[model samples]
Target chain A: MEKKKIRNDIILAVCVLAASLIALAVFLCVRARGSYAVVLIDGKETARYSLSENAEIEIKSENGVNTLKIENGKASVISASCPDGICTAHRAVRYGGEVIVCLPNKLVIRIDSASNGGVDAVS
Target chain B: MKTKNIAFIGLLCSVSLILAYIEALLPPIYAAAPGIKLGLANIMSVFALYKYGAKEAATVCLIRISLSALLFGNPWSLAYSAAGAVLSLAVMILLKLSGKFSPVGVSIAGGVCHNLGQILLAMMVLKTIGLGLYMAVLAITGTIAGVLVGFCASLMLKYLKKV
Candidate 1:
């Protein structure tokens, strides 16, 4: 390989490594603070539970297709019929960036600060 | 003007459509963000950038996104895809004209631009600035994917010249 090729490879490797470390750090910090909300399909506040205090709380959406379980300061989609089942893999969203979304069902489980002012302005 | 050139562009568009459809089938790794994609179809766009010109590449990119969205049955995705596609194409055009980088560099620039455009659209649609944080992750992934696709395109161009 040429000198430039080697240099580019090294740079790419560094970028990837740096990204992995940053993602890990963010995940850890988010997991450390465990408070989240469960919003139902009917636009009602289905449940607001803190992971730190709850041993295990089951939050069922009004449609009943979506259910979330909060335990040990972590929230996860315990069950859903949303085809892809990606929400289940999301495990628990403890960080500001982590989100569990079920599009077909129009349900979103996100982690936001109580003082973030208000629910996200978009959706 | 040349049949070969036209054939090549056609091939690139078809490849992009295939990539887009394959990506669509991959079961979104994240649920809430159903429309969020890795922009894998960009491989063809990057290829066209070097094989044809930036304008031709942009045309191919737009057609791929539109056709893919139409086939996939999500007109809403068009707004975000178009924003990203157009911005990425413009960035690639500028980079290609600068003569500072090779096709690979242009591809990387295009990928980064695509991610930034998508993030901007997300922030606008979601009405949430928090989505900005996701940009960091997208940038990292975009660059990596760009390099891979760029290298592939470079190889193809090299072979085409030999023929």
Candidate 2:
């Protein structure tokens, strides 16, 4: 019984660890420096800003409001009216394909690569 | 359900709710990871699954999620939690039915699937796939949280069996 339990533990640990490592590798490979921060509300493009500009934009959605700040080529949520404040706690994102999500406000700030023409595609 | 079963489910629900409340009061486990949670409430779900069955476990989980959301979360959070609960329960049930894995394994799968479900819902809600990057971090945290919750649950099950 002890041996079987140990084997099961080893198998599960290896499987989960391998999966997480693969995901981590994918994340590292896909992330790249971004040029624009695109804000989407309810899956619609609401605003876009360049990373070079240092400014704070107030995003007011039907649910609540959030303050997004872009500085030092990174964008992050400075403050939010939502309860969890997960978005505000998220680290600044400057890499393409990185996002700061405010679920309560249905707000998303996604960094897009220069090559992808992220917000430009919407325009 | 029999009165006994219903009462057990209610007890599980309240226990899970209290655990969630305690978790909320605790500080984030890691500053680098914004949304990582201890998932301590999952102990009740695992215990319910082993003690009663999947239906009872799901009932306990659903009630806990809805009540917690009503008390402390917003509508969007409700959506995320609902998605996570549904997916996590489904995975855990399937793993349990396989009989190849222990409660600890099932709980690990449950924890990882829960995070995956939430991230998928977020991606859909935001209309962007970029959030998928966050899963890499969440998966690791989920595993650690899962092991802790699983051990607690297994111990509880062992003690309850004697009772």
Candidate 3:
């Protein structure tokens, strides 16, 4: 192994790492558009509701129950029958790709930005 | 391939499979987020790519994913793993052939490519481009995991060469 090659590799690694970090920083600051909440039960999506809509949904499964609430363009799990209740404790999510998971109940509510500002064609 | 080379590939394959099994037993530390892992098996993949060449590295990666699927994953996971491994291996081979980056750099690129490949597949299956948001956090985590895996591979390669 040439020492020169290793030095070059280190430089390349730093450049890529810096580039990825900038991308992440940009993602954090960007405002999401046309976002919605997706309710997944056992890894399969059960329903999708827009973030622009304010409503409450009670998702009951054999595992347990979780009440997902969308209000003021943000989503949260306000209540659940699961033992952990980590989802309920989580902060309300307004950004795309954020999620509230009721693991004990196998319920996942993830926030996704339609970004295109149009209704999803999957309906 | 020589008999000795074949044996080395087989050895790396089994090692990678064992690493995959061990990784499966770890808790999902990220809680609500899934698919985060130490990727210990990738150490062998990176090492083999740098040491034995692309053919052997590809063999190591394929066998690890296949054997791990048999041990503890379903068909769905097998599909994702295969896609990630293939994409990662392809990028790693390209980087190696270029000799423009060290093993660590190549591993980092491989790690990011693996996540991207899986995310692209998920977007296609879900029929929505929304999955791009998930890639942000994953990108950060993937870089960390890649660096750790790469550093370990660096040490392992040094030892193997001496042996």
Candidate 4:
């Protein structure tokens, strides 16, 4: 009985691992390249920048400040005044519907597919 | 519950809190996935569930999450932790009750659910579903962390039973 229980547990763990790997693969393959970076502060749209144009955007919220850098069709938080700096530590993202959020600063940077003749319309 | 049981649960709670404290001290494992951590404290929760059932496990998990949040986290962190802890414990209890999976399997479910719960909360609060990809990243990390925590918990359970 004990051995059977252990076997069941092993099967369960394997299932979880397999499921996660499949999810990761699906996300990676299905993601479309983003054309724009949309910044929101306190759930309000503050700014929108095209990913094609490499630029640095500084966002200031009531809580803190964050510097978002868009270079080479990807967006990343290069710097931040938030205590944790979690946003700054995040990797750059170019996939449509990907996000980098700074909870401390109430800042959110989202990558969006181009609405005008973009991936969303194709799919 | 007996006084001894109450005292033991309190002890388990403190142990879990210490695990949380140590986890906080460690830097984030992957820069690309900011929330990924060892989830070391879950060992205690899984242990409590196997030893004393759902009620004791929930008590230990809640006290640990609440106290750690109060001591080392802000309001936002508290919200995230509370969401994760509640969902994780509930899933662990349900899996345990199913009687097919061992503690390791149950712990794995707990770990994944915990990450899912936190990510769901973040998505709701941020008002965007763009976190879906991030959730995918976390699911993998959470599964790996779950295996480690479950292994340790199962080992601890073996020794504790001999006591």
- Ranking of all predicted structures according to DockQ, beginning with the best and ending with the worst: 4, 2, 3, 1
Q: Which 10 consecutive residues of model 2 chain A have the lowest summed lDDT? A: A1-10
DockQ winner: 4
- Cα lDDT listed for each candidate: 0.66, 0.84, 0.78, 0.84
Residue B123 error, candidate 1, Å: 1.6
Q: Report the Cα lDDT for residue A94, model 4.
A: 89
In model 3, chain B matches the true chain B with a TM-score of 0.96
Residue B9 lDDT in candidate 3: 83
lDDT of 2 by residue, B1-163 (tens): 7897788779889999999889878876545454688888999999999888889889889999999989877787789889988999999998787766677888888898898899898878767666655777788888888888889999999988853
Name the Cα RMSD for model 1: 5.1
User: What is the per-candidate TM-score for chain B?
Assistant: 0.88, 0.94, 0.96, 0.96
Least accurate 10 contiguous residues by lDDT in model 1 chain B: B29-38
Alpha-carbon runs more than 4 Å astray in model 3? A1-3, A32-92, A96-123, B31-33
Classified by CAPRI criteria, candidate 4 counts as: medium
Per-residue alpha-carbon lDDT of candidate 1 for residues A46-123, written as tens digits (9 for 90 to 100): 456655665444445443386777666667787786665656766576664455655445466666545441544334
On residues A1-123, what C-alpha lDDT tens digit does candidate 3 reach at each position? 568767876676676667766866787778564378888777677899988989998888878888888999999899999654557877788776566656456676777787632443343
